[model samples]
Target: MKVKVVSLLLFMTGVMTFAQEDLKEREQQAAFDPAYTSYSRKKPAYVTLKDGTKIEGHIKDVDRKKGQIHRLKIIEDGKKKVEIQATDIADLYMAPSGLEQLDKQANFFNDATKWGKTDATKHLSKGYTMYTNQMVSLKNKKKPTEYLMQVVNPKYSQVIQVYSDPFAKQTASIGVGSLKLAGGIAKSYYVKKGEEIVWLTKSNLDEHFDRLFMDSEDFKSKYEGEKFKWSLLGVYILDYTEFALDAQMGEAK
Candidate 1:
C-alpha cells in the first residue's frame, strides 16, 4: 500500500511538471513581437454593406481572380445558415490591436510633452493620428438621411459622446477621424425614444469632457431617441503595421 501511494504521488508530480513546462513553452513561442507594417492592413471579421446592413461571416470564397464577387457564408445557427455574394460590402473592421500595436505599451505615462519622441513626448504615440468613418440610422429622420461621416485625422478621434439618458449623462469616444458632437443648453422636447449620442464632433476635441457641453437646446432632439454606434481605431503612436487596421479574419483562404 505504501508503494502504491508513492507511485500515485509520483504521477501527480509528473503531471504538474508537464503542465508547467507546457506553459513555459507557450510563453517562449509567443516571445517576440510581430512587425507592424504588414499587420495594419488586416481588416476585421465583418463587413458593412452599402445598404447599412452589417454581415458577419466567413469568406468561404472570393473569386476576384475572375469575378469581383466575394461569396461569404454566415452561420446564423447550426442549422440556419446562408451563403451570400458579398460584392456590395462597404467597410471591414478588425478585431483589436496587437502586442506591438502600441508604441509605448505602458499604463501610466510621465510623458506629457504632447507629441514628443521619447518618454517625455506626448500627443499620444504613433501620431495620435486616426482615421474615421461613420454611418447614421435614418429610418424616419430624413429622406436624404442615409448619413455617414468620416475624418482623416487622429487629433479628432477623442471626442465627447453624450446622450439624453436620465441616468448616464456623458461618455468619451475614441473614434477614428470624425464625430458629430454638439455644443450647449439641455433641452426639453417631445420626442420618441432612440437618441444615442448627445454632443457634436469637433467640439469635444477642444474642451475637457466634463466642461464640453453643459446645456444645449438641440441636444435632446439630436440624441435623445437615437442610437449612435461608432468605432475608434488607434491613434497608433508607434510605426505600426497595416494589419493593425485590418485583421484578415473572415477570409477563409
Candidate 2:
C-alpha cells in the first residue's frame, strides 16, 4: 500500500513537470510566430464593415502574415461564431483585454519612457487598440496594397491618423552611398490625412510637415522656437491634433 501511494505521487509530479515544460516550449515558439500576435483569450470588439454594417462580438482569433492581419475569428452574441476577412472590415476597435493589459504591464516594466508612447494611455477605457483599412506599400514592393493597419494614435484620427508600419524593412545605409543592408527587425511609421497616406521618415518629413501642421499656429510657434527631435514626431503630431480639435470646438461653440 505504501509503495503504491508513493508511485502515484511520483506519476503526478512527472505529469505536472511535462505539462509545464510543454507550455513553456509552446510560448517560446509563439513569440516568433506572427499569427501569435492575436490574443488567445477572446476580447470584446466592435467591427465596422465597408457597407456600414456594425458587428459587436468578442474577437477569438486572428490570422496575420508578414505583419498584416488577413483574417479574424469572432464570437458574436456569445453563440454564433463568425470568421471575417480583413478586406471586408473597414475598422475595428478592441476593448481592453488580457492581452492589452499584459502589454501595458510589460511596457511599464521594460521602459518608463515608453509608457505614453501613444495617447492610448489616456483613453484606455475607450479602446485599447484600433485598426483601420489603409493603402500601404510594403518594402521592396512598387505597388501599394490594401491592408489592415494598426492605429498608433487615435485621439484625433479625424484630422490625421498615425499608423505603425508593420511591413517596414529592417534596412540601414551601409556606407556614404545609398547602399543599404538588411538587419534585425525595425519599425517605421505612417501618417494619413484624408485619402493620402505616406510613409514618414526624417528625410521626407520636411516636405509634409508644413502642410500637415499649417493650420496649427501652436505647432508652428513650437516647431520654430524649440529644437524638435525626430524621435518625438508622434508627440508633435498629437500636439497639432489637439490644436486642431480646439479650433473645431471653438468654431462649434
Candidate 3:
C-alpha cells in the first residue's frame, strides 16, 4: 500500500512537470510569432472607393515600398486590370489564404493587440479582411500620406475607426544575456474620426479616450471603474462604439 501511494505521487509530479514544460513552449512560440501577415497573393477582393463606390475583383498584387503599400493592382471581373493608388482606396477586403488564416489564429491566441477577448481577431474569424487606407506620416515622408492599414475595430465603422499600423515594430529585451529583439509588426494603434487620425499610444490614450468618446457615458463609467490600462484601449473603443451606435439609433427612432 505504501509503495502504491508513493508511485501515485511520483506520477502526479511528472504530469505537472510535463504540463509546465508544454505551457512554456507554447508561450515562447507565441512570443516569437509575427502579429500580422502581409497580403500579396491573388484573392477575391472587394474594394470601396473614397467616394462610396464599390469595386469587385481579385487583388492580384499589392506593392509595398518602404513598409507601406505603394500601389494596389486588381483584376476586375477576371479581365480588366485596374491599378489604384493607395490613397484612392477607402476600404479593401480579401479572403484570407490558408497561411494567413493560421497567422490570424496565432495572433488571436497571443492577444497581439492586448484587446482581451474583444480584439480585431473576431472580425478575421468571421471572414472580414479589415484592411483600409489611412493618412499616416511615414518616417521618410514630409507630409502625412495614405497607406494600407488594418482596421482593428471594423464594427465601429460609424463612430470611429481604429487601425493597426502594419509597419509598426516593437523591441523587447529578453534572456539572461539581455538580447534585444525587434521586428514585431502592428505594435501601434491609430484612431480615425472625421478628418483627423490620431495615434493611440500609452502616453495619449487616457487623454484622448474621453475627448473622442464623450458621447458614450456608459463606456466612460466602465473605463473609470476598471482604471483602464493601455492594453484595454481596444476594448474601450469597441464598447464606446456600441454605446454610440445605440444612441444614434435611438435618436433616429
- What value of lDDT does candidate 1 attain over all alpha carbons? 0.30
lDDT of 3 by residue, 134-239 (tens): 7776542448877877665554455677766555655343421121233432346677777778776666666776677765678767556557555445455555
TM-score of each: 0.21, 0.61, 0.61
Better of 1 and 2 by TM-score: 2
lDDT of 2: 0.61
| TM-score, candidate number 2 | 0.61
Model 1 misplaced stretches (Cα beyond 4 Å):
1-44, 66-69, 94-253
The pairs that clash in candidate 3 are none
CA lDDT of each candidate?
0.30, 0.61, 0.61
Where model 3 places Cα greater than 4 Å from the true spot, the runs are 1-35, 40-42, 51-53, 77-80, 99-126, 138-142, 170-186
Candidate 2 weakest ten by summed lDDT: 27-36
Per-residue accuracy of model 2 over 1-253 as CA lDDT, tens digit each: 9999999999999999997776444323212101123443455677888998988788887787667777888888858889998889998776533443322211221232322244233334443567788777654254787777777655345578877666555444222112122342223567787677888766567777777776677778766766554544645665676677667777878
